[model samples]
Structure formats: structure tokens, C-alpha cells
Target: MKVDALYREQEQLAKKAVFYDAFGKLDSIAGIDCSYYGDLIIGGAVVIDLNTLEPVEKAHTILKLDFPYIPGLLAYREAKAMISACRKLKSDVDVLMIDGFGTNHPRRCGIATQIGLQLEMPTIGVGKSFLCGNIRDDGYVYQGAERTGKLIYSSRSKKPVYVSPGHRISLDTSVELVEKCMKSDRIPEPTRLAHEYVTGVKNTLK
Candidate 1:
């Protein structure tokens, strides 16, 4: 098998998408996002101080996408550029918030999970919509028989965000961490900032 093929197989083995039920401090938080311009991908990441919720460092990169876009296999299409951009960060971050699914995916591995596995760091997925699973009556618990994730209605007037553990955390812990990163919106601050940061830099694309 080719090296990339072997790594994909390795990714499959690295994922532990199930709930872990634990919590930890997030002194430094990083968010990741990507945008596309034609056949090019513009990936961005931002790291912020938890106390101030302000970006202390940021990185962005442009790359020609080699993989075709696939629904559940978004990691293969986007993770490389995202990881490259994230690596440009000079400081360490306690957690990474990604704009994709985590365990909410069919294989129990979303883009966030793949990135987390590669980075070997704590990560959380904050998706705008569910790729899989059904929300319970409480609207907080999302489950599909054995697999589960969380949906948070941060504000009554706003729709809930699909939350899942990417790696190094549990469903409950994912929620707790998101709440700490929340400002006045349903979207987590780290991911929100990352999206804005990436989109802004994407203007250079052809």
C-alpha cells in the first residue's frame, strides 16, 4: 500500500469517538477553518488567550486541493491544508475547535477527529448542522442507537449547534468546553474567529 493509504488506515485505528466524560482547563484555544477558491483551498487557524478571548496568533495557507470533496470523508480533502496552516502557529493551544463533525459522522470519525488524531491534541467539533444522528426531545442529546453527540441551544432564539468530541475528550466535556468559549452567540468563539480569519485571507485567491 502507498504511504497515504497506510495513513488513512492508521486514521481509522486512531479514532476513539465514544464519550469519555472528562473536563480540563483551556488557557489557550485555537480554532480552524478553511475556504475554497476554484481548485485551491485556503486554510486558517487562530489561537487566542482564554482569559481575554482575543487572538494572540494566527496562520493561513493556500494549497491546491488534491482530493475530491467527499461528504463523510472531508478529512482527506481538507485536513492536509488545515494541518499545515495550523502548524504555522508558534504557540501551543490547549484545545482546537473545528468547524466540522466529530463522532457525528458515519464512521465515527469526522474532519475534526482526523485532525485531532494527526495533531495528537484535544479537539472538539462545532458543526452548524448534523451529518448524522437524531436529536432527542431535550434537543441536547443526539444519538443513533449506540453512537452519540451533543447539540447545544446556547440561546433560546438561536438554533442549536451540533457538538461532538473529535479527540481527547467526551461528549459532556465537549459541551462544557464550548460553553467556556462561548461569547454572545451560538457559535464557539474559537471557530467563529477562525472562519472569519480564513475568509478574509481567501480574498487573495484566484
Candidate 2:
């Protein structure tokens, strides 16, 4: 499909996103991330027990890149491998935290939103860099006049990670959960481990 068409699709799907709280107590959380190797995509998922903040289960998947990496339409390129790896997990997690943007995008439909909607699960997005918003003194990220998400400085980092609701989740809860998952790393444990796993797989191939 053309770029314009894909943009339109993102806008349409974003309307289905839910901003209210839709979950009970979160016992476990999973984080997913993808690494690239030429035309291949290596995706990894790590599920951690929320109480101890230790990994309970992990899985990885390697797949071909079907879509080009566009600026805003990242889900088209990476969501496939991410979802595949996530589905490989035997333990069911209460939430899925993905290493990407959620509603904090131009169209409000990011890779995390796409993946959450596809999996019918609650998901949060963690953007390492500022995507498309102005961070206020209160740390709320704003796209134009609408509040999209929040900027949180994790315990071990000078930089802040943007946290946003992907689907079937609220922004406040997204931040709360992400902060709980952070260990001695700037990124949350789930996603941090997932990234490390995928990077290890990529290194092995080289």
C-alpha cells in the first residue's frame, strides 16, 4: 500500500484505542523488542514476575522484514516479529510493555498500539527518545493541545523514557507499571531483557 493509505489506516485504527483502565492487579508483565540483521528481524519477549521483578519466561522469534522502516509507521515493519515472539511465551502476562511509542505518535497509532490491538492485551510503549511531543514541566507529553502520555526518568538514567498507553490501558497505569519494572537500568526490566536477548541472537549470527 501507499504511504498515504497506511497513514489513513493508522488514524482509523487509533480510534479504537481505549484510554481507561481495563485490567485488574498486574501480577506479571512482558516486554518485547526487535533487532535487525540485514533483511531479517530478530524479536524477543521476556516476561517478569511483578513482585520480584525477575524474568519468569522468555522467547524469541526470527523473521523476514516485510515492510520498510518508515518514520511513523513502525508497526508495519516490526510488529510481525514482535507478536510472533510474544505468542511463543507459555506464561500469560498481565501486561505487555513494548520498546516503542504508543499513543505518542503523529496518528496516535504506534507499534505498541498495533500489537496490543492484535493480541487483545494491555500494552504500554516506552520510547527512549522524544518522538513527537512537547514535555511540560509536569512531565506530561503533549501533541498539540492533547495530552498523550508522560515522561518518566527511571532510577538509573539521566534521560527520561516516554510512557504511553497502547491499548486497553490508561496512561497513568502505564507509567505506574513501567516504574515498578525498572531495576538498575534506565529501561524497564522486561523490555531491557528482551532487547538484550535479541541483541545476543544478532551477535551470534555474526
Candidate 3:
């Protein structure tokens, strides 16, 4: 999909959609993470059983980061690596949890959205920090209370990360799944584990 077409597609989907509804069936989930070599990208994906939370399969791939770190066009830089890794997975995933924002992006089509849309699978975005949208300290859980259609300003830098719905999931569901996946630390278990594995491999190659 072209970069400019993202917003148009989102607008069309938004008009006819119910933002949140019980999906009713989800047994397996996959997580994706990427590491960069000075700008070159390497991706890792792991599929885990939702009931046992045990890893069933994993895959990794490396791809050149051809695009610059553009604010709204991040999928162009990372999607190829993610897709490559995901294609290698031996098991099918009912849902995907990505280390990014979902429905929390400027374009409303972040990397997680891109992947989910392309693969026609459910996906969620969970970033360590705010991407877009205002996070309310008021303890409200819903998107309206937290904020929407706003950029998530980072403390370290003014440039914000993008978040948005990936596919077959609601923003509220994304948030809930993220909380469930958390294992004490801020990062979720699948993403955290993938990070550890990929970083370990990168370190060994050094």
C-alpha cells in the first residue's frame, strides 16, 4: 500500500465499524520485535499458546532499512523484516501483538496496522512509551477518556510514535491484551522475550 493511501483507508473503515466488540475466539497469539543495526533492521517473531503462555515457534529475519525514520512512514522501514520473520513461523497465530502503537498513530495506520491489514489477522500494538494520543492520568481506561487523534509526545524528544488499530481488533481490546501480557515490567512477555532472543543473537555475532 502506498504511504498516502493509509489515511483514506482508515477513514473508510472508521465510518462502518464498531470500534470494540468481543472477538469470541482467540487461542494463540504471536509477538513481533525488531532490532536495528545502526539503521539496518532485523526482526523476530514468536508464537505462543495463550492458555499456557509457552512459546510454540519462533522465526527471525534481517532486512535493510531502506527508508529513513520518517514519523508516519515507519512501516516502510520495519514491515519487510517483520513480514519475513512472520512468514517463517511454523504455527499460525490467531492474533499478533506488536511492539508499537495501535490506533494511536498520526495516520491511524501504524506498523501493527499495516501488518495486520496485509495478513488479514488480528493484531495489537503495545509500545513501551506513548506513541500518539493523550494518556490521561485520570485512571480512565477507554480511548475517549485517555484521548484520541493526538500525537503521543515523548519526553526525551518531541517526535512522537504512531499508534493505531492493526486488524480484526479494537483499541480497547488492544489495551486489555497488553495489560494481560505484562509480566511485572512495562514490556509484555512475548515482545520482551523476542527482544532478549534477538539481542542475544546480535551480541553473539559481535
Candidate 4:
């Protein structure tokens, strides 16, 4: 995949603020996660009803690996399988919460952003570790009081994992959603469940 083209496509989606308004009366959200099998990628997309916090549907798939694991080109390697799994959903998702970055990338495009743009849906990126952003520790309390005026630096490489919009959301909303989805830990519940499902499926296959 041409990096420049992909970047341009996502940038356009980000610029079109109208797309962000599509998220109307969202009742459910889905979380997607993948596990690599040496040469293959097996993944699962789990949809949970926000009101009840129960699993509504799940889609899983295994795809042969084709792209190399480039530092920033992860979407190319995993987008096909992720999209395939998402297509298996029988119900429409109000929002998609992915276990990766969104606009918090070198090209302002990440797996979450790419997938959201392709599907034209609202998506959130919640990374497990730092990818490319900075987190200030200016007496900010963790796992409690919400941090105020915390800005993610997309222009800095050494920055921390940024919480930004993907297709149909705002940066502030994304960060708040992430915080709301957290279940007594740093990782959110949707992504944590996805990680467990993906890893469990991979282990069973092995």
C-alpha cells in the first residue's frame, strides 16, 4: 500500500468534520484484537451493548500474512483480516473501539483510523503501550482524578500513545470514552476482552 495515498485518504476523512456527526444514539460498541500465528493473523471482533455491557456478537477470522511488520505500516499487514472479521457482524455497530492508534501516528493514520475510514464508522484507538507521543507527569493522578488540559503531541516522535479521533469523533470525546471504558486498570474493558478472546483462540488453534 502506498503510504502517501493512505495518508492523504485518512487526512481527508479527518478534515471532513461532517463524517463525525454520523454517530447518533449509539447503543453498542465493538472491540477488535488480533494475534499472530508465526505466519498468520487470527483475530476476533467483539461487540458489546453499551447499555447492558453484554457481548452481543463476535466475528473471528484467520488470514495468511503478506505484509512485513514495518514500524508504522502495521495497518497494511493487519487491515485485511480485521476488516474481514468486522464484516462478519450481523448487527450494525455504533462505534468501534480498536486496540491500536488512530490519528496518533507519523502520518496521522493508524490501523484504527484506516479501518474506520474504510468502513465510515466512529472508531477509537486504545494502545497498550507508548507508540509515538508524549505524556506529561505534571502531578497528574493516575486511576483516579481525570487529567486536565492533557494534550497529545502528534508532532513529537518521543511522545506517548495519543488518544485521537479516527473517523466520526473528536479527540476530547475519544479520551473521555477511553476513560469511561476502563475497568479498574489502565487498559479498557472492550480491548481487554478482545485481547483475551484473540489470545485464547490462537492458543486453542495451536
Best by TM-score: 2
Collision pairs in model 4: 133-159, 133-160, 134-159, 134-160
Report lDDT (CA) for all predictions.
Answer: 0.80, 0.92, 0.67, 0.70
How much is the lDDT of residue 98 in candidate 4?
87
Please report the TM-score between candidate 4 and the true structure: 0.80
What RMSD does each model have against the real structure? 3.2, 0.9, 5.2, 6.5
Tell me the lDDT of candidate 3.
0.67
| CA deviation > 4 Å runs, candidate 4 | 1-21, 136-162
| Top model number, lDDT | 2
TM-scores of the candidates in the order shown? 0.87, 0.97, 0.77, 0.80
For candidate 1, write residues 1-206 as lDDT tens digits. Answer: 35466456645644554356334566898999999988889889999898888899999989998988656777888889889988999997888889998777766778888888888778888899867877677655455565457777665327878888888877777888787788887788899899998888887553
Task: Give the Å error, residue 10, model 4.
Answer: 6.3
lDDT string for model 4 (37-100, tens) is: 8898986898887776668788889999998877766788887888888899998788888877
After TM-score superposition, what is the CA distance of residue 83 in candidate 4 from its true location, in Å?
A: 0.9
| Candidate 4: count of backbone clashes, pairs at least 3 residues apart or interchain | 4
- Residues 99-168 of candidate 3: C-alpha lDDT, one tens digit per residue: 7755566655667777776776777766656654555554322354433322333334444332344667
Q: What is the alpha-carbon RMSD of candidate 4 to the true structure?
A: 6.5
